[model samples]
Target: MERSFNINSPAEFESISLQIELKNINEFTREMNLNISWQALEPDFNASMKRFGKKVKIPGFRPGKIPRDRLLQQFQPNIEAQFMDDNIQKYYLNGLQEKELVPVNQAEISDVHFHFGEHFSFTAKFEVEPEIVLPKMKRKTLDVQRMKFISDQQDMDVAVDQLRKAHARIETVEDGAQEKDFILCDLQKLDDSGVPIIGKKFEKQLLKVGDGSFTDEQKEKLVGLKPGETARINLPDDREKTSSSPYELMVINVEREILPEVDTDFVKLVNPDLDSVEGFRDEVQNKIGENFDSRSQQSFERELTDAMITKVDPGAPPSMVDNYLSN
Candidate 1:
């Protein structure tokens, strides 16, 4: 790409001209090789070091009093490395402006090389917006299942039951564990060989059954377990941070949950906004309808999105999405 530099060039840009070679990778991507010259960078490099010397602590000399020659000898390499990083983007941007290329995502930079009093150059790959219109396309009429949320008498009764259960009294059950039971157990972390790792145990951890919070393996071993029973649980390696680890759980005690009666008194306690059970049931029905309406809207949006995606040009590179996510 040959274009004149219109933007005011920076003082460190000692090059009278910049060379930018743009190679088309595809309809939406390009590889740009930019060559920048360093006519006089030593002056700026010295000034930057002088400012840094005031802040950098040295053993022999007080801060800001290090001799220029010694300072240059000791920190010159470090300063050069920083200068390349600090100025590479500045030069790349300048070249991009002159050539009028607007990249859609972060450019992949490579082959960077620079020398004092010499030229600095690098190559960068960029994903650009392809200049093409989405062609007219059609698909069989999408059969989005029209969601209907009709909370009848049975649904209202179920909602009331759940509300009552949420305010249930917690009691200790000596007759083994059941659903909605809180178990007090210790989780001991283990190595790959199923041996307990010392100092990695979690003690007195409280877990609620039927909540789907514990791993399926742990829940399966725990549901029928009585007090004083120990279950060796092998957790799955599905978590992002934790792998499959063995745990020896000594069930200290089991607390069974007893739900309150879904009567006038319980309805008054849970639903203070509504005075009677009839009003509370109506509110639950409205909430269910609202949820179904929201889901229908989302489904319609997805249909439109799928249609537009099918209309896009086949040349649209898959890396475009991957590149955007990485950036």
Candidate 2:
């Protein structure tokens, strides 16, 4: 690439013309032309000196005492020319870079001259991004599975349990062990050395004896147990250990929970919008349906995004990646 410059006034302004010749071996050659007319260097230098003279301090005088000619002689031409060169180079480079043009070689500067109070001109040369021929892609289709939401018996049971719990009240019971009761107790484990392990103690813990959560052995241990009653629970052989050692837990104190019966008042307490159990159940069903629909749409959108990206299969250049990383 070759560039030419015609600086009419070295002290005032410059006029530049740029011609770009791009040659790609065994490919194509492209040419581009640009013109720049920057303001004269002398005027800018004089203006800079005038501004500086107003603030510059001289040894023989106070601040703003320096003469314009003296200030120009000291700093004007070099400083003003440097500033103009920086701006002009930035402007030219930005235009080329925006057009994705890369110069394979240094741009040659020619016809360089500068005159006072005249326009500056310059020329630049560069290569551009190569034309890409995309390969034809065969369209292929595949069947995909679609998911739908359906309510099950377990879902109904969970809804009913939540409603029942919401309406239930805690009462002091003086009777025997019952189902769905929270038993508060403390637990201890024996280390391999047969000593009581003291970490992670349970204080006034609540355990619902039934509600289909306890194993048959656990249920048998809890049955007929009262407050302050302590029982030893055998740890399962396959139980996951907290540490890398085996430990055995000894249950202490079994306090049972007493769940209240489900009624219209309970339904009203749980659901402010519903006065009856049936209305609350209807609301739960609607909520479940709405949640399921939202999840289904999200899944569909994700699948569609994957499919679109697969179809496009865009290619990126190394230089483009480097530029992105630099930014």
Candidate 3:
């Protein structure tokens, strides 16, 4: 809105014009120019002085009572500076409203000219949101490498063996002892002439086949032994701490590991979720297939994302890219 001037001066200046021009330098940038007439800005300046007067404090007067001339004389620079800021913002908003333009960031003001009697003018430059032109996309194909896991009979047998071992029943064997068997025997330290050393006998001592504590000779002697069988074997003497000496081992008991049959009760004991061995094998195969499918899907998604990025190289602003790298 242009204000009417009671005395705007020469006939040529009778009508004051507020000029605003917008120049588009590129698709993303625009320059805004504003030329404010003194007639239009004088009202705002007078209004600002009154507003300052209402809030300013003086030595000998109450609030809102200071003389206008005195207040202007005392704080002319501050008042002018504040009024310039407020007027610039007001005029900038007016320019935006008139042109119907939206800026992406705050406008940067340059070449400012402002005064009480002279015309106010400035140039504001800023970037606007760009119009993204998406490329004409055809059907793009991405290749995915997939590995299908199929459980074979050998894999199923291995799985069943593991389950059977986990639920195996361990019992004492009174006959031949295999590689991983256990034995309870009376171990007596003997003298050179085959007499048991007094108080040097370990009674009912438990040991396992292939136990590192025993020498190879001792393990070999105990493998084919039954209850009440006695073997005079040479082992490391605890008293001597370094040398091998013969000892009498009377086998008290022998133990063996027995795996359960793949029956309903045994399957239930091992896996409460599985009903039968065939069902468990099927479930295992299905799980393997599902895992392979999931991996394939993930690979396909990654390929698709990479392909899209390659197709569309969306560049970011220089300032944003610089800031990101700096941090």
Candidate 4:
């Protein structure tokens, strides 16, 4: 692409000539070769000098009134460097606009060639979105099962229970462990002979009696186990083909979670505007419904993308993937 335009200024040296040669290195990658004539940049350099002159401070000379030659002698190198850096980025953007290309990643600029009185040239390589050709549909319409999320009273009860648990305090228990108790214990993996394995001990670990992974048998083993007592727990092991391994858990301390009473006071503590427990429950229900709706939408989008990808497998550019992973 080649174009010439005059700088929007009264003192014009000549028309600014800019040429961009775009090349497709691949379906999703492109390289741009840009060249700009010296006449195009001369007016900008003079304008830049005037802009810099207003801010330049010199000894024995008033600001913005210093001799052009004296100012250039002191700050010409710095000014030229800033000018080139700024214009290089500006020209690169211009090239993209001229070619109507949207890069998915930052361009890798190389082979920069510029001098004070000569033409400027540079090369930029960047990644672009790949063209996708969708396959013809086997059916007339897509068959997608839309999930309708309904928040019922049972769901609200569970959400309220979770809130109560979140605000629950831990209290040291004097009796035997219960199903919801947390026990601080030391676990040592045992061999077939019921002997502790060396270097297989974990200390100061808190084990919840009612953890989701705990089976009924495991809960039975944990229940009624008091401090200073040991329980043999058979846990599933992925490393062994035998499927399970035995571990001796020595209880150090038992703690119980004391849930707060859900009343007007608790509702006010949860949200200051709410004066009634019923209002707080309604807010919680609304939030739960919103969360379910968001999750359902995300699931639908993911399933739709997967179904489309099975037909149109448009691969992503490495640079785009790298950028996504880095972020």
On residues 1-327, what C-alpha lDDT tens digit does candidate 4 reach at each position? 122222121222233457989899998999999998888877767666777788878889888888889867888876665556556666777777678888887778778776566787888888899889977787734656666676788888899999998888999887999998999999999999999999999999898887854548899899988889999997777745358889999999999999999998789878999999789988998899899999889888877777688668789999888878999
For 13-132, candidate 3 gives per-residue lDDT tens digits of 222345988899776678989998888888887777777777788889988888878988897766766667556666776777678776655677788876556788888777665555
The list of candidate 2 runs beyond 4 A from truth reads 1-146, 176-180, 188-219, 234-239, 242-262, 314-327
lDDT for each residue of candidate 1 in 1-327, tens digit (9 for 90 to 100): 111222232444423357889999878888899886665445545566777678777799999999977776787766666566555667777777778887766677778776555776788787777676767545654444444444567766776678877899988888888766899888787776778889988888887876654646556777877778988876555756365667788788899878887667877888777778777677778876787788778877787677556556445455677866778
* Candidate 3 lowest-lDDT run of ten: 1-10
Residue 188 of model 4, lDDT score: 96
Ranking by lDDT: 4, 3, 1, 2
Candidate 1 wrongly placed segments (more than 4 Å): 1-21, 35-79, 93-106, 111-113, 129-132, 136-162, 173-180, 183-252, 314-318, 321-327
- Global CA lDDT computed for model 1: 0.71
Model 1 clashing residue pairs (backbone): none
User: Model 4, which residues run further than 4 Å from truth?
Assistant: 1-19, 24-29, 35-101, 106-125, 130-148, 236-244, 286-327
User: Mind giving the per-residue lDDT tens digits that candidate 2 earns over 75-98?
Assistant: 565545543554445435543554
Report lDDT (CA) for all predictions. 0.71, 0.53, 0.73, 0.80
Name the weakest run of 10 consecutive residues (lDDT summed) in model 4. 1-10
RMSD of 2: 12.5
lDDT of 4 at 271: 91
Cα RMSD to the true fold for all candidates: 7.8, 12.5, 20.1, 9.5
Candidate 3 ranges beyond 4 A from true positions: 1-18, 58-60, 97-100, 141-315, 323-327
Backbone collisions counted per model: 0, 32, 0, 0
**Prediction 3 TM-score vs. true:** 0.41
